[model samples]
Target: MSNLQNGFLLDDETELKTLLFEGEQDHLTPSTSRLLLESDFFVVAGRIIGHSFLNGGPCLVGLSQGIIHVLFGGEPETATVTESDCADQDVREVIRMLQGTKDLSEEEKSVVLSLTLPWDLPGVTVNNRHWLQEKILLHAVLERTAQQVKQIRRGLKDTGVWEFFSSRPDAVPVLFPRASEAEITPQMVIDNINWPKDEDIDEDILSLDDHCLIMSFLRRFIENGTSDILKSLLTFWTGWGVVCSNLEVEVIDCSLPQSSTCFLTLKLSKNHKNYEDFHQDLMASISSAYSGFGQI
Candidate 1:
């Protein structure tokens, strides 16, 4: 599943372009490359996504909501297409122009006509501008990539999950989540942890001041960390981007932070005199793990 996820998200070996999709990060749509389509790449991508979900592995995630709607058999006309969905900057500018109440300037008219002419759409007029805007948007977001979308549908069918997707509209977000929906929160991390206990007396480790202080530092770090930090920490602790069911934290006698990814355990040294030292060590540890440098 990890390999599948990487295969879809990583760059192509020959061209350094993304393997299956394109556009801004997290707003991806299926690639419309003729070469990729001719090779049935989208179909295979769909199958990988379905298989990953069925096997309870990582989701493809970070697909455009509009594209996800079309992928699951929703009408393209009904799918919302904001400027963000249009990868072309000029097209996005055109979309923004269309949303205004002001009449198009001569230059703006020329810009709009240039785009629409290629698609055989009519030039904008006072009476037809609204309709033309809608058409232009649809063309930019969906029509241009129609074949790729169709192949994805076919691929999903091959995996025998097309019916499930078509029937479960709610499942769309789960399989291909929006960027905001996929963000990891500090509470999410805190909730999944299994704090250590005093083995000698069977007492709660939280009762110890050093353990409490270390845990406080961990919480503060997570709360203040960037999204990359959260993801790196998760990967360092669990050997995966997603959180584990039972993350364990143990206060130890060492000076640096350490993790056993196999056990989902983060070992924090209680020797730090202040949060600054703890934060630095923790950052180094997670950064090393994220970069495949192993524990520092």
Candidate 2:
């Protein structure tokens, strides 16, 4: 739904069918029995198959179709060039011509097809029979590029860090890892946390991961009447993993996210030293949320 809201074209049922299988007119069938898949293609194909099984359905035939879509559509593809443009030119030079694209615009994407696809044209077809065999090397290069791209994308998607930053690319200061744990103070952690962190953090300071884990704990505080959460945060010694019954932490009052930017203000115990430092870091995190690097 977020992807839809973000203007991404969701694959509809028809498009999904076209993606998974040959259309009725294409008359293609799966060849599952005697397969000699390359190592890289096999890995990509396996992932798509698994994704389809879990998301699409349990059918094996559907899995095969899904694999086919991922191989060609692993990423957005370039446009094909028309046959006339590169008809008389050297195919190698034509390839060299298109290699500079850091980002392919819709118009230019297919332009390279004019060079390579025509290699099979009537006049050129007879002369390149040998080159066609050599095309195996070209196929290998493309397959390898696609494999590498999938792994890169998968890694980024798995880490919430990617979502956090990609949603606000201009937030450079927040990109740095939280200051070393030893240098962080409990008050510093409270100042910065608008959400629960991913790990049990020790006292010196709570890092970004700690905030992600703690967000949930603070929600009930909002429901309860106590408004000052600062003292509760300081109860556990730094570095405690799971909460202890004796020293369980709780939130009092807090403010976050009247907007997408979380401007958290925790009233940790009064008279804490480095109070100004924690405020500065909280401001930086808010600035990051707003896509502005906080003022140094």
| TM-score of each model, paired residue for residue | 0.77, 0.18
Question: Which 10-residue window of candidate 1 scores lowest in summed lDDT?
Answer: 198-207
- As a TM-score, model 2 comes out at 0.18
Q: Give the best candidate by TM-score.
A: 1
Question: Can you write out model 2's per-residue Cα lDDT over 172-192, one digit (the tens) per residue?
Answer: 223221123113334344443
Which runs in model 1 stand beyond 4 Å of their true positions? 1-28, 31-48, 55-62, 100-106, 154-161, 200-212, 226-228, 251-256, 293-296
The reply for model 2, stretches above 4 Å from the true place, is 1-142, 146-270, 273-275, 280-296
lDDT comparing candidate 1 with the true structure = 0.76
lDDT of 2 at 32: 19
The residue-by-residue lDDT of candidate 1 on 148-191, one tens digit each, is: 88887887788888888789987677777776776788878888
